[model samples]
Target: MINWHRLFGLALEDYFTGTRYAVEMEKDVARKRQVLDVVIVRGTGEALVDPCDGLEDLRPHNLLTYKSGQESLDAWAIEELIGHYVNYRKAFAPREPAARFGLYAVTTRRPRALAEQVTLTPVKPGVYRLPVVGRSITLIVLREVEPCPRNALWEIFSFEAAKVAAGAGMYQWRQDDHFPILEEIYRRYREAGIPMSYTFQDFRRDLARETLPELTPEERLRGLPPEDRLRGLPPEDLVRGLRTEGRLRGLSDEDVAQLKDLLERGTSRRQ
Candidate 1:
C-alpha cells in the first residue's frame, strides 16, 4: 500500500524548499501520541514564488490534514483536525491571536458527510471555507482544482491519471534531488491500476528542459562525451575555435587524408 501521508508530507517539503514556510510531518502536538498530519510554520526567508491553490493566504502557523483517495474525508476527520489545532494552539501559542493560525483540510475527493454536517462556503474553484467553532477552515478538493502550474503539487495527490500526468509535466521541484519521490508516486499509481500515459522518461525530459536553460554552456556539458558535446554544431562551428595544430593534433595520417577529402568534397558540392 502507498504511504500517502508520508509521501504527501515529503512532497510538501520539496514544494516549500527555499520558501519562508517550514513543513513538519507527523508533528507531536501533545505527549499522549497526538500527532498532527502536517504543520507548516512561517519562518524568515524568500516567500513562495507561486503559492498553491488553497494556500494563498498563509498565516504564521498552519495545520493541515490530508485524506488520500482510498480514505473518506468524513466528519471525524474534520473534528480531529480541529482538535489537533486546539491542542497545538494551547501548547505552542496560547496567547497568540487566532488570526495567526490557519486550518486546512486537503482531500482527494469532496467530503460529502462533512458537507452535510456543516456548510462549506465556496471561496473559489475547488476551495471551500468551512466555519466551525468560530474558526474558518479551508477545504481544498484536489481533484476539482484546475490543472495549472500553481496547483501541480495538489494534482500529484489527486489520484486521477490525467491530473497526475499534467502535474508531473508542470511541477518543477524546488530542490534538485526529489526524483525518487516522484518515482514512488508513479509506482503507487501503477499498483492501483491507474493508467498513466506519462512515463518516467517524459518526466525526465521535462525536468531537463526546465533545468537546463538555467545552466551555463560549460555546466550543461560537464560530463558529456566529445561527440555529444558537438552533436548539433555545424562543421564550421566545430572547428571555429580550434587553431590549425589544435584541429590536427588528434588526427592520424589516414584520418587527416579522409578529413581533407571530406572538406574538398563539401567545397566542390557547394561550388
Candidate 2:
C-alpha cells in the first residue's frame, strides 16, 4: 500500500532535492540571517507529466494510499499527483513562488519527529523551519482543500535550503526524513531512462581509469608462470609484461577463461 502522507512529502522532495542542487541565496541583513531557496527547474531528474494522466486513482475516503496496479506508478507519478493538487488548489493552498509548490492533508504521515530532535514551526501558513540542521531545512506545510487524482493522498510540498552558513559543514544536507525506500524510488525515477540502479560491477566499469601495474621478470614468474622463472632476460621480461598488463587492464570473463587455458598449456608457447 502506498502511504499517501509519505508519498505526498516524497513527491515534492524528489522534484527539488532528488535532482541536483537547485538554489539561490539572499541575506536577511535586518534579522542577521541568510536564506536560500532551492528552486525547481529543468535539470537531470526532471519530467513533464500532464495533470490528466496522473490522478485517475485518488478517492476521498482514503487518507493515505495508492493501491496495487496504481502503486506501480513510479516517482514521476507521485510528482504528477502533487502537481495536480497544486493546480487544483490554486485558490486555497496556492503555490508559494518562493518555494514553488503546495500541499494539504492531515499530518499523520508527516515525517516522524526527526530523531535529531528537530521541530518545525510555521512562520506563517504553509511555511515551516526548524532550529536544527542549521535551520537550513524547511517544510511548506500545505493546508487547502482540493481534489487530488491520487485519491488516496492529500498533497504537501517541501522546500529546503541546501546551502549552509559559512563553516556549518554537516548542517546543510537535505535530510531524507528517514525514507530510504522512497529515496531509492526517486533515485530510479530521476534515472528513468535507465532500467536499473547502478551495481558494484557498474561502478568498476564506470571508473576504469586506474594505473596499470609495473611489469618485471620475477614478478611474471610469481604471477603467471612459475616454470618460466629460469627464462632469459627478454623472454622473462615479455612474459611478465603481458601478464601484468592483462591483470591491470581488468580482464573480461572470456579473457580470463582463455588466459587460464593458456596458462594450463604453459608459457612455453609465448616464449
Candidate 3:
C-alpha cells in the first residue's frame, strides 16, 4: 500500500520551499508517541510567490490533519487535530495568543460524517470554515478546489485521476530535486490500480518543454556533441546564414568537392 500521508507531507515541504514557512511531518506534540500529521512553523524566507488555495491565511504556527480518499474524516479526526493543537501550544508557546496558530483539516473527499454533525460554512468553492470550541478551522476539500496552477498541489492529492493528471501538468516544483517525489506519486497511483492517462514519461517531457524556454542558447546546447547540434538540419539550412568561405572553412577537401558537385547538379536541373 502507498504511504499517502508521508507523500503528502513531502509534497507540502516541496511546495513551501523558499517560503517563510517550514513544514515538519509527523511532529511529536507530546512525549507519549503522539504525533501531528504536519506542522508549518515560521521560518526565514520571503513570502510565497503564489499562495495555495486554502493556505492564504497562514499564521505563525499551522497545524494540518490530512485524510486520504480511503480514510474517513469523522469527528475523531477533528478532535485529534484539536488535541494536537492544544498540546503543541502548551509545550511550545503557552502564553502566545490563539490568533498566532492556525488549524486546518485537508481531506481528499468531503467529510460527510463531520459535516452532518457540525455546520461547515462555505467560504469558497472548496474551502469551508468550521467553528469548533470557539475557534474556526479551515476545511479544505481537495477534489473540489478550483483547477488552476495555484491549486495544483492540492489537486494532486485529490485521488481523482483526471485532477491528478492536470495537477502534475500544472505544478512547477520550486526545487528540481523534488521531481523524485512526483515520480513516486505516479508509481503509487499505478500500484493502487488507478487508471491515470498521464504517464510519468509524459510528465517528464512536458516539464522539460515548459522549462527549456527559460534557458539561454548556450545553456540549451551545453552537453550536445557537434554532430548532434546539427543533426536534423538540411545542407542548405546548415549554410544559410554563413558566407561561402565560412561554410567551407570546416569542410574536408573531398567534402567540399562533393558539395560543389551536388550544387552544380542541382543548378543544372533547375536551369
TM-scores of the models, in the order given = 0.82, 0.19, 0.82
In Å, residue 164's CA in model 3 sits off its true spot by 0.9
Candidate 2, residues 147-177, lDDT tens digits: the string is 2332112231211111111111111124445
The 10-residue segment with the lowest total lDDT in model 1: 199-208
Deviation (Å) of 11 in candidate 2: 3.8
Better model by lDDT: candidate 2 vs candidate 3: 3
**Poorly placed runs, candidate 1 (over 4 Å):** 225-271
Candidates in order have lDDT scores of 0.91, 0.33, 0.91
Candidate ranking under lDDT, highest first, comes to 3, 1, 2
* Tens digits of per-residue lDDT for model 1, 125-231: 89999998899999999998878999999999899998998888888788777888889899888887888899777888887888899999999999999999888
Q: Relative to the unseen true structure, what is the C-alpha lDDT of residue 150 in candidate 1, on a scale of 0 to 100?
A: 96
What are the per-residue Cα lDDT tens digits for candidate 3 across 1-271? 4388999999999999889999999999997989889999987899987677789999999999999887988899999999999999999989989999999999999999889999999988899999999999999999888899999999898888999999999887877687778888988888878888998889999887987999999989999999999999999998899887997898899998899899999999999
Number of the candidate with higher lDDT, 1 or 2:
1
* 207: Cα error in model 1, Å: 2.7
Question: What does candidate 2 score on TM?
Answer: 0.19
Q: How high is the lDDT of residue 21 in model 2?
A: 28
